[model samples]
Target: MSESPSSSQQQPAVGADRPPALLVNNIEVIYDHVILVLKGVSLEVPEGGIVALLGANGAGKTTTLKAISNLLGAERGDVTKGSIEFSGERVDRMTPNDLVRRGVIQVMEGRHCFEHLTIEENLLTGSYTRSDGRAAILNDLDMVYGYFPQLKERRNAQAGYTSGGEQQMCVIGRALMSRPKMILLDEPSMGLAPQLVEGIFETVKRLNEEEGVSFLLAEQNTDMALKYAKYGYILENGRVVLDGAAAALRQNEDVKEFYLGISASGRKSYRDTKHYKRRKRWLA
Candidate 1:
């Protein structure tokens, strides 16, 4: 009924058989030592697998990524409970630089390229964490350009002048230069054309299949995220409310009505439903 992966694309799925690239076990994050943001959230990203964390704004999606990448400390946020493991090692206490050295990198929301730097320079910055020679870095640069030819054309342009799509590609290209085993991407589709979004996701899929790079992407575009991610977790009020394989989630009734804006009931649309009790049940 299904075709097996060809030899070239036969990367093993993360499961009991193979350990995941990232494991977040019931992590709780607090901001300013009093305000709780993440409430016992947990998820997994399989080696070379693409996982999507889906939610609305303030649903703790970015907070969750920050927690895993050890970035919450900069914002006066801390993980007060639970642990995070990357590649079977404890990383909850490791600094962001330490985590990067260990093949974990986070591409923050807003495509944070140095506005003053040239496109090429911004990409070069990601290689600073590596002790590898310039030759290797150049090779990786070419590789990234191959995935994003637009960046190659505008290599000399200042990052601030580049289009949003190109800037997004530049940031991701920079991350790839680090030779990451996994990338924690946040809100990749924000403020981009639909076609540009598709192209970016396509590149991500190619990298996952060809380079065996894993991704844990946080996105609010449910339809697009589920289309690209192999598995997905939906967050509501700072906790995972639903999670499953992407295909199954795409077909789920509640997910359809609430997230995708596709109502399952024939009577009326989810937004058109005025009953709070009914909406609560659907979300539950």
Candidate 2:
């Protein structure tokens, strides 16, 4: 939040040597050609870097992801202004299927797997865009199982029957089958226990480190997200009000009190302190 030099210096600069994996520049999204959701939003995901998009409910995080993957059209939403570039190519005009071929895949917020299909079948659907042969696909499947042993154990079970956490892993594993250059992940910790959230984030960190995959993750779990991401952006009312390295964000007093729900004195129950509203510095 502060953008001080010390905070900015806490982490290594992202994408300093090469181009970013994805870049969204001054983009705006409108629904039904009337209501605007995103107001001149801009951000970047460095190649092979993990960046977190943090915000509360109705913050337009999902809309931003949908815009990147070109799924806005399904909801009568369109990017009326600005540009989105992936690997230096303009993708604002590309279809969702085309984006998949270009290695930009999105794991939606709800972990939308095929409810009627088995976990394995749902995972196999991710490779629909690939023509790389069965051997590669089989190898990737093995790799997915390696990352998620739980998913491997439940591979034969129907996806609709699996636990929420397992379904989360299944969607992410399915995304991996596409061999994505950048993944737009939304709210991965939605309905899981704290320990399960921690496990998922650890796996995400491992994937980023070992697979050289870049990620633009939108998460409501501020603490966990900042813990795993190298850099982060805080979205408020569809606008990026603050952005900095994860270390800096963690140390920021404003981020601690608001997003992390930590006060200067100590941690308190946010629900109990509903009347004690603190003004944001940016808004003030």
TM-score of each: 0.89, 0.89
Candidate 1 lDDT over 91-198, as tens digits, reads: 999999999999999999999999999999999999989998999999999999999999999999999999999999999999999999999999999999999999
lDDT, each prediction: 0.87, 0.87
lDDT of 1 at 100: 93
**Stretches of candidate 2 above 4 Å error?**
1-15, 265-284
Candidate 1 lDDT score at position 226: 95
How well does candidate 1 match the true structure in TM-score terms?
0.89
- Writing each residue's lDDT as its tens digit, candidate 2 over 1-284 gives 34432332332237477567788877899999999999877788889889999988988899999999999999999999889989889999999999999999999998898988999998899999999999999999999999999998999999999999999999999999998888899999998999999998999889989998888999999999999998998887778877889999999887888888778877666565432121122210
Candidate 2: global Cα-lDDT? 0.87
